[model samples]
Target: MSLLDFLRRRGSAPVARERLQVLLAYERANRGYSDLLAVLREEIVAVIARHITIDRDCVAIKMDRGDTVSTLEIDIEIPHKAGALLVGT
Candidate 1:
């Protein structure tokens, strides 16, 4: 396939837009958005630190509250492949 065709095909792949939308809805429904975010951040950092070293300054956790629910938005900055650490983190 041509480069353009390959790029287009890759871009056309189905995205997790629905999952994100659901998460947003869930977040909005939850109260205490900031408190929840703080708790999530602490948990995430604690979980990450258990396995590897992470730059605390780079760690970020946010809550996106939609019109109905609140969703936990976790943003982590790690230096290695430790995706599994985030499972319970």
Candidate 2:
């Protein structure tokens, strides 16, 4: 592959990060709890960061509200091979 192709593939990280940020922002704005979610997300990421280095911008936290229950979804991208070890594969 050409250098251009390699560079193009590597560019996806920023794009994904921005998309996740936008999505999380939209979710927070719609359902409220913006402050609580922000703190919750940071705390969760900090705990994970203790063991593995991660990009803060790449973390995505989503909250879904249902009729009877609420759901909190978090997506963290591990940028290295260490993730496999974490999963105990």
Best by lDDT: 2
lDDT of 1 by residue, 1-89 (tens): 99998888786535567667776666677746637657767888998788888888788776565667657667777765565565646
RMSD of each: 11.7, 14.4
For candidate 2, write residues 28-56 as lDDT tens digits. 67676648889988999999899888899
Off by over 4 Å in 1: 1-34, 80-89
> For candidate 1, what's the RMSD?
11.7
What TM-score, computed on C-alpha atoms, does each candidate reach? 0.46, 0.57
Candidate 2's TM-score reads: 0.57
Model 2 alpha-carbon miss at residue 8, Å: 51
| Model 2, runs deviating above 4 Å | 1-34
Q: Which residue pairs in candidate 1 collide?
A: 26-69, 26-70, 27-69, 27-70, 27-71, 28-69, 28-70, 29-68, 29-69, 29-70
Full-model lDDT for every candidate: 0.71, 0.85
